[model samples]
Target: MIDVLVAGGGPAGLAAAVHARLAGLTAVVVEPRTAPVDKACGEGVMPGGVASLRALGVEPAGRELRGIRYVDGVRRAEAPFRDRPGLGVRRTTLHRALHERALGLGVRIVPGKVGEVRQTRDSVTAAGITARWLIAADGLHSPVRRRLGLELPGGPRGRYGLRRHYRLAPWTDFVEVHWSGQGEAYVTPVADGLVGVAVLSRVRRGYDEHLDGFPAL
Candidate 1:
């Protein structure tokens, strides 16, 4: 039986698998997607996130936006947090880096959607796949957690976020987060002559609803 079976391949799951293998656990990750999977994020790797990744020996695959800038946000002031440093990288890059790191450390990645998980006193079977223990690192809405009878709910209406890539050079080494009354938008530079920009709002609105208002977007 496997020591641990992870139910997702996202950042959290990837991180957990890397750490788990380093700890000498026979771990496996069940990812539903084949490859070139993506996430809808501004792709900014906060300094803290980078430090943690470095500790795990994860080499980043995307360009790093060397500095951090704070946009007033959809509701806050434009001043910097000053308390900490943030790294801006793409979500896909982060995923790829973590994916490799996990594999190098000997984590088995099962690339398929988990159907069900049955638990007994000594072992847990995920859709007939058995393991000594199971970790549900799926997305915010984790099916594994649901199957195990745990409740995962959304946080109080958070900003709605959207992102796009551009082929121009970056405006600054720092990631620029822009704020409007509706929400916040973030900009980051990634590899391949592209820049990643994200728009966030507390209320859910149609895509391109505020595109005209933001000239930079």
Candidate 2:
């Protein structure tokens, strides 16, 4: 039996596995997706988050972010970090780095999903593997949470995000937030020649429609 069984292979799960290994515990991560998984995200790591990743011995290559800028038409506000700069790393890059770190630390990553977990007084069993503890980092709508009846009641309508990348030189070193009545668009430079744009809104609409709202972007 392993000391820890992680129910996903995303950043959080991989980080947990690395932490387990650093604590001298055996960890096994079960994930159905392949490595370097990409998803819709702002891809902006705050300074504290960057430090945390570095403490875990994971350094991802990306453009450095000096601060944040909020834009509303002609009116805008900017704030620079007082200490260190943040990082605008791509999601895949971050995940890959964490995955590699965990593997290097002797964490076993299995290519499968944890299904129908069963837990006793001392151990937890899932996906034909048993562990002293199980971590459910399966995401927002985690099946593990659902199976364990740990889901909370739904509140107000939640916002959705859509991300895309553009091949262009970064004009600024700050993550830009373009606000509109419909939603907000986040523009961040993930690479020297690539920028990622993510739009978030509670309203259901197409990506182009959401982008139309942020004319200032």
Candidate 3:
């Protein structure tokens, strides 16, 4: 029997297991994929998010960016915030670091997907492994949540998302979020002279909508 059986191995799951172990509990994470799994994310951690990482003994992935400017469908303006800067990191870099940290803390990483899970009085059984608690940190489309009949709030009605990556350098001291009538663009620094740009829109259209528009990136 285990104290906790965590489904999924993303940031949330890894964080939970690490904390659980620090609090003196037997934790195990069931995940199918290994480290460095590709994802569609901004690759930048907000100031507060970075602070959370520090609590877990993890460092920021890239240099901090301060010149954050938000645009309103056309022009841009500095966001009203009283903070130093946000940390820009690559998705793979952060994932690898956290995976390593979790392993260092005596976390059991099982390379198996949670095919099934059941609950009983004071216990939960995921597949054949039983534990006192079950955590569903898989991702947006979490199977555990669906099995447990949990619902998460959705975004606005007219909002949609489209994320793709490109090969670029990690430049700029701050992430640049461009607001446009077509959609919203988020840029984060991944490495020296390399950047990761993501696109989010209120309309669900083809991903190549801006493949020819963005010249600099």
Candidate 4:
């Protein structure tokens, strides 16, 4: 049996597989989505995360961020990273880097979802595969967690996020966060001529409605 069976192909799962291989353990990742999966996120990798990725021999091409900037109407604040610069990368670019790193380390990836996991004292089984250990990195609403009765009760409605990309040059080398009463918006430079904007709010509304909260963006 494989030493590890990762139930996702996202960054988390792929990172787990990479770590497993780095430790001389065999790992297999199961994911239903295609390679280089994309997701709605701010797409900014902090300095520590950048260090960790470098340690794992994964370097993605993107803009370098020197610090974070916060904006509230006319008020603005900036904080630079003390040691190392962060990375502003697209989600798909980050995923592809991690996926390629995992593959280079001999981690096998299969296109499938983990469902109805069966576990015992010694091993775990799911999706017609068995491993010495199973990692449930599927997502926030993991089906394996529910099938194994490990899911917790739903919490109150919280913030939702939406992200979009603009084909324009970034104005600064720092990630900018715009704040308002309703929600917040994050602006990051993901590429040479690409910028990503992500909005987060607890209120249920359209993306345009959420963007309206951060008019200064």
Candidate 5:
């Protein structure tokens, strides 16, 4: 039996496993997906988050970000970080780095999905594995949360985010936020020759539809 069993193999789950191992506990992560998982996100690790990752001995390969820039075609504003710089890393790169670190720390990763969770006064069991504690890092629509009756009521509709990568050199070190009448577009340099653009808007639209408005991009 392990001391900690984590559901999901995403960043949170892997991080939990690493922390458990640091605390001298045997931890295992059960995830349905394989390593180097990709997800749609801004993919920007802020300064504090970068420090946290460093503390876990995870330094992913990516571009160093200076700060943020807001542009509306006419007006432009920029803010540089005062202390540590942020990182713009791809989801896959970040995942692979964390996965490697977890493995090096003796965190066992099992391949399976957690269905029903059973617990006793001293132990918790899921996916036929028993542990002293269970961590539900299953994400937004977490099955563990639902099965444990911990899910909260649905809230109002939220904005949708879409991301796409372009094979182009970065124009600036600062992350660019292009504000439009409809929504905002976040542009970050993930590598020396790659730039990721993500749009957040209330209305669901294709990448081309959103990019059409940002001619300067």
Candidate 6:
């Protein structure tokens, strides 16, 4: 039996497995997707998150971000980090790094979706695997949480986030946030010649429609 069973292979699940191993526990992670998974995210790891990653001895390659900058068509503002600079890493890169570290530490990764979960007073079983404890880091719509009747009610319509990568050298060391009338665009440099742009908006529109307002981007 495993000491811990993680129900996802995302950052949170992998991190939990690493921490469990560090604490002298045998952990297994069940995920449907393979390694180096990609997802839409801001791609900016805050200074504290970076430190936490370093603590686990897992450092992914990426660009160093010095600060954050906000700009509208007329006004601009910038703030430098008081402590360590943040890291702008792609989601795939981060996942691969964490996956490698977890494997090196002897964390078993099973490839399969968790269909059902059962728990007793002493152990929890998921996907036919039993463990002393189970961590449900499956995501926003976690199946495990839903099965356990732990899901909360849905909130109001929230802003949608869309991200895309461009093969262009970064113009600045800071994450640039451009605010338009409809949405906000976050530009982050994830690699030497690659930048990731994510737009968050309540209005439904294509990426081109959002970028049309920020011609300088």
Cα lDDT, model 2, residue 169: 97
Steric clash pairs (candidate 2):
none
**Alpha-carbon local distance difference test for all models:** 0.74, 0.93, 0.77, 0.91, 0.92, 0.92
Better of 1 and 6 by TM-score: 6
On TM-score, the candidate that comes out on top is 2
Provide the lDDT at 78 for model 1: 40
Which 10-residue span in candidate 2 carries the lowest summed lDDT? Answer: 150-159
Q: 53-166, model 5: which lDDT tens digit per residue?
A: 999999999999999999999899999999999999999999999999999999999999999899899999999999999999998778798899987888244788889999
- Once superposed on the true structure, which residue ranges of model 6 sit more than 4 Å away at CA? 154-159
Question: Could you tell me every candidate's TM-score relative to the true structure?
Answer: 0.83, 0.94, 0.85, 0.93, 0.92, 0.93
Candidate 3 local lDDT, 45-116, one digit each (tens): 878878888888888468676667665545568763366567878777788888888899899999988867
lDDT of 4 by residue, 66-173 (tens): 999999999999999999999999999999999999999899999888878777899999988989999999887777777778877772445788999999999999
lDDT of 2 by residue, 122-160 (tens): 999999999999999998788898899988888245688
Q: Tens digit of lDDT per residue, candidate 1, span 1-217?
A: 9888888888898898888888888888888786447756888776777779989998676665556666552443343435555556677777888888888888888778777777799999885578898888887767677667787465344456677888888767677777666776777887657788777777677657855446556
Highest lDDT, which number? 2
Model 1, global lDDT = 0.74
> Model 4 lDDT vs. the true structure?
0.91
TM-score ranking from best candidate downward = 2, 4, 6, 5, 3, 1
Candidate 5 achieves a global lDDT of 0.92
In lDDT terms, how accurate is model 3?
0.77
RMSD of 6: 1.7
